[model samples]
Target chain A: MNATREELSEKGKKRRDFITLTATAMGGVLAGSIAWPLLQSMNPAADTLAESITEVNLAPILSGAALTVIWQGKPVFIRHRTQQEIAEAEDAPMSALPDPQTDKSRVLKPQWLIVTGICTHLGCVPLGQKKTEPRGEYGGWFCPCHGSHYDTSGRIRKGPAPTNMIVPPYTFVKEDLIRIGESS
Target chain B: MAKQSQNPYRHPFVRWIEHRLPIISFFEHTLKHYQVPKNLSFLWTGGFIAGFMLVVMIITGILLAMHYIPHPDHAFDSVERIMREVNFGWLIRYLHANGASLFFLVVYMHMFRSIYYGSYKSPRELLWIIGMIIFLIMMATAFLGYVLPWGQMSYWGATVITNLFTAIPWVGDSILEWLLGAPYVGAPALNKFFALHYLLPFLMFLMVFIHVWALHTNGSNNPTGVEPKTAEDTIPFHPYYTVKDLLSITAFMVIFAFFIFFAPNFFGEPENYIPADPMVTPAHIVPEWYFLPFYAILRAIPDKLGGFVAMISSILVLFALPWIDRSKVRSLTFRPISRALFWVFILDVIILGWAGAKPAEGNYIIIGQFATAYYFIHFLILVPLVSRFEKPSGLPESLSAYYKNSCHD
Candidate 1:
């Protein structure tokens, strides 16, 4: 009877050990399964956030008119110039501006009234030049924020602004539609 | 041990020097004296994984700086030149960029692992706090480094973030100017940011040392959440933990390599391709995704100072976690209520992240407010309260209880 009792006790001990081992293993597996997916899920979302592009519309403004749109929270001005403005822009002397360029080089094939809008100075938005101002041999938007003036070509003619207004990469969607965010 | 006596050059001075610096002896002592819980599972590897990523960031950051130019005029063109002409420049840049996301990924897991296992409790409180410090420094370093590329996102991201200080009541403008070294986020800001970004990692490295020291001081918290009480319950640190840590690191590298090689551009902003134009702002100026949750918190409050306070408090609250949790039990396995609350916390963080990505409009603000409130509640109220009222399953009486209990059947 003593031997039989000892044998029963031994068997019970082994069974309990097995159960504990199994529970521990199960716990590890559960932890791992949860953690692996959590770690993996973090990667794809970050990738998607980084590589995504945005689109901007440029159809509302008429020729010789400028409008502002916020991209990444900074204001970007898109100006549309009429055909006459484009012709007049060419007569502006390259010597008068910080960066001198002909219309063919600055704007895309046909749509013109120089597309650049950034102020060359400290980057504040420059107020638009009114139509009544003397062409000053070059007719374009004048930035009133500082005294910086530009001819129709969007070249920096006079003032503290260092560079001519930037010409952003844009493409026409249709006769009137223009996509400003990405190049085709 | 006396075998060195055969060599006459092994004089008293040499012996004293050897005794003082005894690296071999130190290793032996570490191997012998250091005891780890025998039941530690894979979750323990997250800490090491995070440490490894920190090293990777520092290494890649230093290399990237070799070709990087900090001046605003040259910064954009220089980065372009690196991508186009510099040897393996693209590889270095992508690695550094992707490395930031991976570092944060590992760190969050490391932190969560600490939370779930109750690693932050009692004697290990200092370790957890040190880890939090590392997290904060990492955030600052990554933020500054993001501006180095001088892309559209870089410029506007800097602009918006620097403007945050301007929310301060009286000296806000001066503070902003001080940070920029100029009236605006221009050349001076970029230059100074580069200098500081270059310096912060070394500081991170020192803090990591402290983190490890504190970790070792308390020993590692294990999966069972039960502290080891005797030799029978512990194993030597070398063969047991070294092998496990190495295996897990190897596994982590495989995933890291997969991103570095295949999906390099996956985490970068497309607007960054355009050079920064101050006058021409991109419509949506979002920071890097890692910062989204905090950014969400920043925008959550309608008031400027209130938003800033809320944003900072979100991080500051983490430092108080160790004390706030009142549970006698360390591990969540036995604490049913705490486990449920833990999941709620996770969901709250995710909701905050989602709210961060959405524009602060209409329902999003309400959602953010709710999530932000839940975030604080989880720490300040739920942790302590749940810990106090919840009855934990009784613990094993000693380290050898498992063995004794098994023997008794």
Candidate 2:
């Protein structure tokens, strides 16, 4: 024992022990506190949060076509699912999904397939919204940045994206109109 | 024991190449197998953040340079064209610009971490010196990069900074002429700045290599500021530090991305958006936020040459710190007085930066002068006096004992 450690009595030693232990714990927690906001700040800021809701007219989107709409600065894909596409998504085997989710679980309605266009691997928007863009092997959205493939239900069928494309919290107000950002 | 391994690489192709070049083993020895103190704090990740920012800056800077025009007439337009015309150029520009601030932020954290732990003392002095050299190069690179935009702040800021050399005694003007390569801060100066901006990062990279070599030689100072005594006290760099660094880097990238996407011009002056105007200087000219503390130090002095010298001396004072501190113990955890004063020094620097942000007038000048004086006093006077008179009696015997709270069996 050194001078201070030597001078302390049994009680003082225990108190000192507690102090050091707390200090170490606090130091770790405080270090954690510094990095907390670094990650948190990446989450949507006030302006993005403020401009959260977006209204999309579903009337213009044809039976097979997908329309991309901006909601809170992220692309939301609203595809008017063709009957054949709906069947493919619903009948697709659970074993094939890299990130498995049933078509019933993914959609609020069978006719409209609404999912965020951003790839789960990175934030790149997958390119199946337009006719010219290749929809990858699964005949769904393809991310050109990487080669992530999503099915008609926006399930991750292949590549780096670990999860299914998110079904953003949205609700159908009118029969032909959908509102995004407000809870369903 | 030092003899080379005949089959360091398991793969036949790798082994064949290793026989000639030996890079695989070099990677293993220097990085993969390199040992570091296991008790290193999250604060230690500051170096990793700095390295990450350097790569970001260099990659973005190279892309910026490809489209950048050196001539003053075209420079501003070229930068505008890059933003408007070139794809993802805005992202690259914002990242490079903001990356400089974050780079300095992390480097300062790294430096302060060293100071707080007394990692600069004794055996690690040269390691600290090499780090300072890297910091100096970083500052130079940042200064040159700021000039490339050829905006109002860019031209006037360059003019003001280059004019500082004119504060030198008989050969001041000659020095200025040599530096500018012209009578005024014009095409020649901008070209030189562009060329040097491209070059300095490579120099900083060399210094960083030497700094790492020195670091590996000295090893790392732990939170307890105690050297490792046994194998248990240290771990291989690959698994522990590599993962630790990635976590910190990911966390840091969030903030970096937040700035790039959300607040691209947060650290930038609005005046810099206006193209270069030599005739009309911005009413309240300020250097980038990273340079503010030194800029405050420069203006604090009444005399031109004195301010310049004092500004330079502010950095030089850090070079003498390992010697100036007379304490036997390294960590401020044991030295309560130094710990308290260390914080006070940080507050003082922040105040100086605040003063620098404001126009140098009245109360700001008075406060800045006091802060500047306190800055030197903290290093030269208070540290030595307090460290000598006060005893750090409860100094821990070993890293394991203090941190692990029990001696290893």
Candidate 3:
């Protein structure tokens, strides 16, 4: 111990500090590299990420009727909008909406509106897909869990939901075929 | 430390080994010869019980883990299987489950006892901080362990807690996904949590070792809070504390046994017996009873981010306590005003726990809001002000003078 102390004293403070710093930097990088893999391993695994697409044929849905499909383990509502509903959605004042989105901007065509059925407030499946189900004041969907109301455009119009209904990434795979979870 | 004289009786074998390793002496010093404040009351038994509880939890936990399946589908049924199929498995599971509650109960008493005696003061601050770190690890371990059963309360509790991170700005959602390992709680989250839950207790054991090392440096604070100044003020560890602690442990086991045998599910939510369903959230979800105070604090704030911050700050503030209350007197027995405030603080925590059990609406919310406000007030404002201003009764010249060798060896 005395000999080592003498040697360190001879090396002087500056050299010892440099040696200490270098060793610390090396140790930190080594630790970080070891930790990175352990951390990255926790991200979504390949099978889970492979939750890709759900194809829904619009042929069966008449105007004013809606179809509910399950995509990515969540319900997605595809409503064939009536002309009057479309017109009403288009005319609703933007300032009145809790979470605002233009009706035209929300849909690809004037007669079709598609939005994920889960409530934005908390993840409850909203009521509105069936004719007998109660849609709230705006005539889109009503969340029984928290009483959130959506308009014809599937925009959050009232109650506790913080934003408009989510529009999952989707595209028209065919004129009558809409594939959810794939965007192109 | 006082040196031990060499034994003249030479067992050549034992002496040779002792010269090389000294492991026997190390154990002797810590377990047999260490001096403690002579006047320590039964309250000091909390530490011994806490250490004993750690052993119970780890042994029971490891056995339960043997039959516990980590996957969501098998998790709930496997717990039931353990209860039904494995001989004496129900006893082991109940011991482990109820063991967690008792462990927390003991630890909370351990902490509050320290707080009441001002044991977090100087020279003991690092020991207290290490104890706090042990506590944080305990909370994390308990939470991860709770989710392993994968029932309604476990699943929803995971969802609620993991989502709280999303209240952070910019990187919140990313952090939440990283924590859960998916868009939501599932197999990945369960696997990671199980891995961590098993690992933390060993880490906590190591921390407790350090905490004890820190404690031995300054020795224990007693009811009088006066430092031992002479040999007369202290007692050896072997018989006095060991027998007293053994007695206390035996007495405590009776109550713990009552819970394990008679009220096995007393600390658990009935909803947890039902398997987890992702689609339907239970109308009211609650955490384990031990978590109630902090849980109430979380919901007391209206804003998501604010509530998360407040709840975290409640714990983090304790780490700063040694500096916060800088009073010269170390125990509440000397500070009458502080003692009154201490009891009130205890009541506020119980009220918060009560509020936490109720749904977050109506009068419950209002009650929680008041209790939450008072908790912070008592800690940050009242403690400091009282510490600064309270007239402590004149302290004894020495612990020997205080006890008058009433507890001689």
Highest lDDT against the true fold, candidate: 3
lDDT of 1 by residue, B127-160 (tens): 9888899899999999899998899989978876
Q: Is the docking of candidate 3 incorrect, acceptable, medium or high quality?
A: acceptable
Off by over 4 Å in 3: A1-25, A56-70, A73-165, A172-178, B1-13, B403-409
lDDT of 2 by residue, B273-372 (tens): 9998653445567899989999888878766677789999999988888889988788998899999999999999999999888875668888989999
Evaluate candidate 2 by giving its C-alpha RMSD to the native, one decimal.
Answer: 28.5
Of the two candidates 1 and 3, the one with more favorable DockQ, higher being better, is: 3
Shares of reference contacts reproduced by the candidates, in order, are: 0.06, 0.00, 0.16
Candidate 3 chain A lDDT trough over 10 residues, lowest sum? A117-126
Instruction: Give the Å shift of residue B365 in candidate 2.
Output: 0.8
- Alpha carbon deviation, residue B3, candidate 2 (Å): 7.6
Sorted on lDDT, best first, the list reads 3, 2, 1
- Give TM-scores for every candidate, taking all chains together and pairing residue i with residue i: 0.68, 0.68, 0.86
lDDT per residue (tens digit) for residues A1-184 in model 1:
6569889999999999999999999999999999988755423233222322335455666667666664433344555777777676666666655676776777775344434455554344455533553333345555432245666666777654445777665667776666665574
